[model samples]
Target: MRFNRSSCDKCLDVCPVKAIWIDDQGLHIDRDACTGCMLCNSICPADGLSIQNFNFQSVLAKLKDLQSPVLSCHVVADNQAHIKIPCLGLLSETHLAVMSILAEAPVQLNLTACKKCVNGVVVNKLQKSLFAVAAKLMNGSAPKIKLIEEKADLHFRPISYTRRGFFDALRHMDFPETIGYSGGLPAGDKPKAYADKAVPDKIKMLNKILPMLPETLKNWVYENYYYHLRVDSNCDLCLSCVMICPTGALKIGGDGSTGKIVFSSAFCNGCNLCAEFCSKNSIDIIKGFSGKNPSAYASCEAAT
Candidate 1:
């Protein structure tokens, strides 16, 4: 979920409005300046920039009622039965993959007006990348989703929240009692803290979606969705990889006298940070995910 050492600036690169920025503490959104276009949310690999109101859960729930779901941004004219989002750029691979697995009919993304939109270029790229990854996961199986330019004519209706709904929301507010220092630390730190405490959203979504896929696709996803690490004979058991792993997928420990390194496939996002930091070139990343748990004991001399 978190890549502390990651120099990935995909979100920053995609924002057409320059409303998002990263500092020492991490990614920050200038909400007043942001139009809620959701370009950053779509491209963020860490699942970091989500709009509170338009989340995957809500989208999924909406899909349950429609046989053919069309997702469109506000700029587009509403279709008869489409689920409208703030921006098509908000839909990530996880969202598309999950929709494909759960929806009975093909999912259509209405991008009829994207070319004229200010965020068109990034939106186009995001959709293409998500489509490519989804197709790869399906092993060339016909994708049950599509991106197309088709306009529909319909009016938008605003949802009115009831008094009880408003009151319930008030009960769930997470407001701090007092304002403190605005910003100083890097935004990566928050994600790092979260990674230390919970599984990344991608992994969690993959686990849920895998079971629903066909057997071949399921196996393929399990095999290709993760990055596998191998320790060779050259490994000096320095345990540097363990310490460098951002997701805590790789861990090191000892029985006081003996040291060992263990890897949990569940946690690895395949960022290659561990392999990158290994000084001995001792770690090799297999392209596919491993079915077996990964563990290795340090050579006795290295443990000493």
Candidate 2:
């Protein structure tokens, strides 16, 4: 959504089939042409793309049953020992880091078929980069999450649901249509602009995993994994950055006479919207992680 800020075109560039594109209206994906390869979903820094049926929590749930877990794409031959994902590229650094900490043994990522697949080249590179980052964030002592090219021995079993089961599921559904209301405004309330409430799931995952990492690794991630913004004295409080921030990471507040800008590093995905939009060039993006201080580098005074 902040595509205008950093001019990010990662999703468009990575589409193996050229299913993604951009225009004045914003990003667009041709669902009919999308192969569900998920390369775009994995590489988007802002978590802009998502797979409809892939529940990350469910994948984590499955990990509880295994001693040594191997993750591979469904395109790869499945083995009973390995947990298959729709695409190997779906796993982000946060996903890998969490799995590494939760597993009893080293995590194996199968990428043997990636080299030959249309989506494999970019995904293979991404897998390696994310693995390296996850490993570094865990310190040297962290379990080795290796990328293996060897084929696995696996099987697949399909489950079928009965008519009665389907009926039972329908019986429990809370249908929104059941709310007896016609299309009319409330008695006193007025319509307002829609506010985006969706926070990137990756951010939530990162927050949970950060505390479990080794102190040294945690420090490194905080210093390097996130982007920090610094507001210099050149800022005239135009508030352009605040309005453009997709994640609500930048905020402006105060009375008409005085105002201040505040930032929360935890919410920033380093899209560089503020820095890029600043007409005065007062905002600078600092690469790496900042500590718990939300106001660090982002606090600035302005006259309204």
Candidate 3:
């Protein structure tokens, strides 16, 4: 699913790789080591995920529709389509692996148009690495991989009317204007926050594993560690949280999996979209940094 405040980041929370994070733009994903279980997509609340160019059935049809270099196609669904982003750079390798297996098609990630991807060249390299691993994992039954480059107009409607308007959007988003053209904050030689705290064994283990993860999952882990949420026992299995979550992070499984909602941090963006939609007043959106943001926190944390 497309990562955004409109979606949930449950997948981001559970990912061992800490591949997910929320930025001013939206959810960013790192593709390496994603494993493609698609548990994240299934758990997403918004159903915001749609395979980039084709639906499930169409992907299945590709197995029979193959011709020349066209083996199987990997279609990505990324929410960051607004800027100059590449198609292949949209999802992590785990997402692609899920597509390769479940869709029964060799993945053909399209990156031909990413010459100036807003996400950058690093994303392109990640796509290549993940594809290789995915191909190897496919065994002898692997599908063909193809890179199709093409450009489609990004339908970014101007949030403002003029140059001042551009600054206005930044101001509204609370973004620093003087920072480098690279979308990050201004660089300084100051020490980082909370870097020298006493480390628990569990936290130490997490730190050791952090660098090995895909970017998307990594960010998710960091964000959840910084901003967390919870579900209370008062939940009524209403599926309200599931329906409202944009990224499918809140899942209501069949066979009473819905009896208790499963909150996957990997898929949550901490946007509080689910908290706003709950009927029984059973969900809470807490800040990972402070444990709860009073402006967005709810009393009872519910699930399923």
Candidate 4:
């Protein structure tokens, strides 16, 4: 996965197993535990993570030469001698569910070992989430999906840490304290609320009167610093964006009227998270009103 340091952790969210992690040295992939499943590229919000792409026809021809049968799967395996596909974030829960029904052989996913990957967060997410979804569909039974990390005796090449750090800083100029991937919440059945609704007057008047509301709610109403974008015209009003926003900023609300995407910048950290993964390309990242210069946070925010 190619990740800008600002929010490279996108890979950490998809792993079926908790094989991906970050530290002062940066992201690491535990090759021994990774299940080469390319799920990380599928779910990454940045569309940065990817696996080596193997042409399906070529792979099929090679399998024929080996006298082995083709493997039918909804997921792809990560290997070095493969084509370049963006991170495993491309896959979804439905893809995993379908794999459970189509394949019969014990499935194996070959992924990067710790030493071989610069983008460990992306690889790790692919492993964990695949396992979680597989377990649910298989009723706790072993999934056809299996994890395997690749081993390559390669040497570390030196590069300028200063240059890397500089560019990373630029991308994260407006980011929050902690951005990228969600975890620690257990599954539940609570009914979720999407974009917050408001009466027609509330809709038209909120932006104009934002400075007049209570401090606590003022930012909430105007989405002060948080960046928001319109759902594409194709948006089925899926409300998925409402559900996935970590800050509880976007919500579905309206008056017998067409529902709208409401946002609260009070809780936003100026993370370009919502815009990164938007399938519709309707969102854009812009500066939020933090009442201070953006450089202040850029200088002070902790590095991941």
- Backbone clashes under 3 angstroms, per model: 9, 7, 68, 46
In candidate 2, what are the lDDT values of residues 202-263, reduced to their tens digit? Answer: 76666666666777766776765566667877888888888777677787766678777877
TM-score for predicted model 1 compared with the true structure: 0.67
TM-score, per-candidate, Cα-based: 0.67, 0.72, 0.28, 0.28
Backbone clash total for model 1 is 9
Cα shift from native, residue 11, model 2 (Å): 1.7
lDDT per residue (tens digit) for residues 171-286 in model 1: 54333201111221123332444334344565666766665577776666666566566776677778777776656677775675765666676676666767777788777656
Per-model lDDT: 0.60, 0.63, 0.42, 0.41
lDDT of the structure predicted as candidate 2: 0.63
The regions of model 1 sitting more than 4 angstroms off are 1-7, 12-39, 48-54, 74-82, 130-135, 139-141, 152-195, 233-244, 279-281, 292-304
- Residue 75 of model 3: what lDDT? 24
lDDT by residue for model 4 (1-304), tens: 1212335565686566767777765456776666555555455432233332222223222223221122222233333322222233334443343343334443344454433444444445556657765554455666555544544322122223488886874463323111321212212233224333222211222233344445654443233323333444554456655555544546666644676555554334344656565566555445444442211112111112
Off by over 4 Å in 3: 1-46, 49-54, 69-86, 89-95, 102-107, 119-122, 125-304
Clashing pairs in 1: 24-185, 24-186, 25-185, 25-186, 25-187, 26-186, 26-187, 26-188, 223-289
Candidate 2 at residue 179, lDDT? 27
